[model samples]
Target: MSGSSKKPMRRAVVPVSKTLPTDPQDQHSSSEEVDPIFFTPSPSPPSNTPTPDNASALPCDHATGEPHRHPNPTRHPDFWFHDGSIILQVESKLFKIHQTILANHSEVFAGLFDVPPPLPTGTTEGDDMVLEGCRIVVLHGDTEKDFESLLRAVYNPSYFDDTLPPSADVETLLDFISGILHLSTKYLIRNLRQRCINLFTSKFPATFDEYTAKSTPQPSYSSTRSSSHKQERYRSDTLMRALHLAHSCNITTSLPYLYYCTARLSLHRLLKPRPTDVDWQTKSVVLAGRERLRYATLAISYSFLLVFERAPTCAEMRCGFASGPGREWRSIVLGGESGIGSAPTPPTAATSITNAGGVNGISASATAERKSKSSSNRAPNPLRLYTRWPELGVCDRCVEWNKGVHERGRREVWERLPGMFELEGWDELRKAQGS
Candidate 1:
């Protein structure tokens, strides 16, 4: 529900402040397991600020009484991201540091963005927008040496943010990732809602396929006519960057579904069939379908988590299709959305009234019943991937993360199995849930 504006992103103390404490480096740390944070669908930030471009007219939607569709500074330009196009802008030293990291981790970045996410193809790093922002206040000069020093400071892996005592320990990074994941999921949610609602009223695609029509990678994309290039893909390097940030904070989440949905909604443009399109019995069977086994071979620990927990919120959110919310609730353990809470709050049966002659007390799953009923009556297809991760479903590719990050060789103490993915306090989280 973030307000629609020129910008798709908004800066706030909300997530960053909330996330600073969860940076556990890995979930095995001895710190107490902090509870999980659920998702909150706040309306997009208000786009009340008038741009010089709109000086001629008032910013109002006469029909809906909403703001006009204008870009918000908070959001990166859609042109740089959507359609068969690419964007490579380097305005400041911050871009230099980002380029350094991007260069060092290009493979991973490629996997995340699903395209050659803009390389340092722009002018000097001094000209990058992100870097320029930093230079104005923090870095000052746009030299590599100065930027490197700043890079050392920003991702210091130490407890200090810009001289002031670090507002967070290293765990803040993980929260950053979680926040991004939430945003990515949020992006899917809001966009999909708009699409579904529009399609329902008028069966046409909601904005053109941003991916198919354009790309913003540094290098141009593969020739559009190549048959070999048909593996249409979607992976937001931006979203992945957020995922990495969240990992730095020791928060855990699912990339499989995020990637899958991004690939579908962002790339291929065809969503999987929804449960609402059919009936519940068939939906339940579809959920427990053979596809579940596709992820069984990733990593041992991940397999365990997958098997025990199953896909919870992500599955529910990824596709409107879900196998009864009740079953989903039992399997879910954490999230940042209303339906997806951090830890499962044990349901308590209560004494209450009922319809007609039945004066029975409220049943334990009364909440679930209400959810299903309400969702059933709704008139649109739901987009839940951007809302929940594992809760929705995991893809075949990322299933390997759970057993450990490095399956190929030896790992340092800090690089232990749990260390790589940034879920340092799993022991704490596990204990918190009395698992």
Candidate 2:
């Protein structure tokens, strides 16, 4: 959403891509992002540009089914096109396509319940990065606290007070967990988490991590059941989770507890009047600048566990280009690996590092973006994001990331971060943590 997310790149230590050597004159300018010789558009393109806002550009796919993938990977970026395409130019390649379309068609379910009014249908503001889903008003300050509040407001009793007829609550909950069907709760949580995670990861990876780690720890639940008839008691016990995730699914036993449990924890703090994380204002920027619907999986859970994996530049540590060679230093910036001879910056600081906005040290990102745009050189058509998804959830991105990190030796790399996975209160946990 903010910093262009990079793929785990691998190549020889030689200069892979060329950058227009910072002109001494241009270099005098106080910014890092290199300006394109021909500036066709900007993220903050003015309201007057011929930006399209066709609601149909939004994809309506579900998180459960085979996630909609661009039929033509040769067509666009991972996201579906909602309004227009982001045109990127790298050397000779160009690609363009709408990357944030939702094909789920299940948003109608939100209509059945009370959703905050649909975002302005035809607004000209979105080509930037993230989508301002049905809620278009620009919010101000304290994103985390405000975001938490939004979660709570959404759980308003009226929203969930509607009782379903006698149906299998367990099946509905399972579908919600596995994302096999459309329920407002399932859609909102998955979409919101996906959207928020993406935007924060790209723009503010550190802040995202802080938010994720600090959002709220899920409540402990005793899943042990003495008998199957404990349904009524069980639901009553977990009412907190349900209110937080009013997805209107048939509630049941095997919902993995984490499904509703995690969301409840997040929303409880969200609904509060004045959360500690709040400052003067409230704002939640959906996955970088992409809209609520235009999401791309960057890492899966297993991958996420390996926090030490670094992007290309940091991974190899400034492999100085000897010819026109610039000063380079070997660094390990992730998971507290600040000690690898040279200090490597984490992805979170990417914005600050590239204030003027350069690709965050990875060459493939620019290439991928440019390649995606070139494909759309012709007069374009409405685009879509995914084809079909599974009930399994799109945590695949994190899983993929773990695979990359494991290959790099996660524990050794993570040693850089100060207390990465170090368990706390060893003395106390040792007293109780059972070796």
Candidate 3:
């Protein structure tokens, strides 16, 4: 639909001025020049201007008056034939679709049909308009596979189900939903866009409070591995694509969370060059998101330092594990025992902050307090000190006290995520819809 034209359809504006600059340099002195300013031709565009590298050349058949017939015009199995009366083509694939059904769901299609077909007087049939022998519309600027996904959704009454089918793999469902988003957006289908957004937001949720309350935290190694694998289930490239779609479609609610999830990936993984197509704008967003995440993680670390600094010290000798010194607990929180060496020795006088640890592996450890160094090589999380606190080595009173601190600290950081990342408030973000 979009193509370059040698001559613009709209008339070009030509200026007619009565006055001219009096300065010698600005004036044309030649008598034959007609005072120069009275009649000035517009400058021609530079002949050497580079064409966009990303722009695809239109098929030669298009200019030669040859109909670009599809090589594989066979209809898809599930979507091929039904009670449909209209035909739509996406490149090689031809789809039999119902006009009324699509018109009802999409304002764009409805508006298209609202225009009376160019028929002879008294020669028109009912409301449905058939062109030549059939109502055919050829779609450009999208892949057949994407259109098929959208048509499948548009035709099926139960496509936007509240629950996913048991046979559906979560990742596959997400990809299809993303496809719906792409096509729906291109076609101006609001209902399908909203459905896709709702489903995607639910799948990759922003907060873990609802989930964490029910499931107990696993040990560090297993928890970290599980979180990594879960992230792997949906490839990073897919998430990046969805993020680009959200921005293009004005799906603001998904932006903050998508950005955060993308930022969570390690630099090596995030920076890995992929063959997949990505626009420059989306790539810029990802780079900026990395910086935003760093700032937020640093802020959370500072919060941990502040909380640990003010915590009441246990002077009683009966206090187990932590009886060595009040400062010992602070050391453990800042990775003093984790062998990261980033934390200040005297945690109370700490002036700098460190990186936040893994997302799902937050925990505390009293055994870590006793150990000269951590056994694992993972970066330490301040909240983990309280969540996975070695209860075996800690006194009952200290364990209970640590539990309250851990919960409060983790929740505080969670609440601060938006502010830390410079995103809109969580509540407002959740309510946003695609335009």
Model 2 vs. true fold: TM: 0.15
Better of 2 and 3 by TM-score: 3
Better of 1 and 3 by lDDT: 3
RMSD of each: 25.7, 28.8, 14.9
Against the reference, the lDDT scores of all candidates come to 0.27, 0.25, 0.47
lDDT of 3 by residue, 1-435 (tens): 345634332111222121211122221111122222111111121234221112111111222233434433445567655666555656766566677888888755664444333343212233222322334444545688888778878777686663466446547666667667766765567778777766666655456463243234444564535432222245677776666555545465556556655655555666576775344444556566555443333345334333432225554444432323334444443445522223323333222112122112222233333332442222323222233345224455555665665567556655655554455666765554424
Of 1 and 2, the candidate ahead on TM-score is 1
List the candidate 1 regions with Cα displacement exceeding 4 Å: 1-151, 154-241, 244-371, 375-435
Candidate 2 global CA lDDT score:
0.25
lDDT of 2 by residue, 1-435 (tens): 545653222111211011221122221121334332211111233333332233222221122222112211122233223443232222211223221222122242222222122334443233312233432111111132333222232334331123222343543432222222112222233443333223222211122233234232344455454322221222322333332222122221111122212222223343343432221121121111111111111121122221323333333332111111011111111111111111222232112333212355455455434533432221110011111122212234432443454434322222212121122222322222111
TM-score of every candidate: 0.18, 0.15, 0.57
Q: What is the lDDT of residue 367 in candidate 3?
A: 37
Q: TM-score of model 1 relative to the true fold?
A: 0.18
Best by lDDT: 3
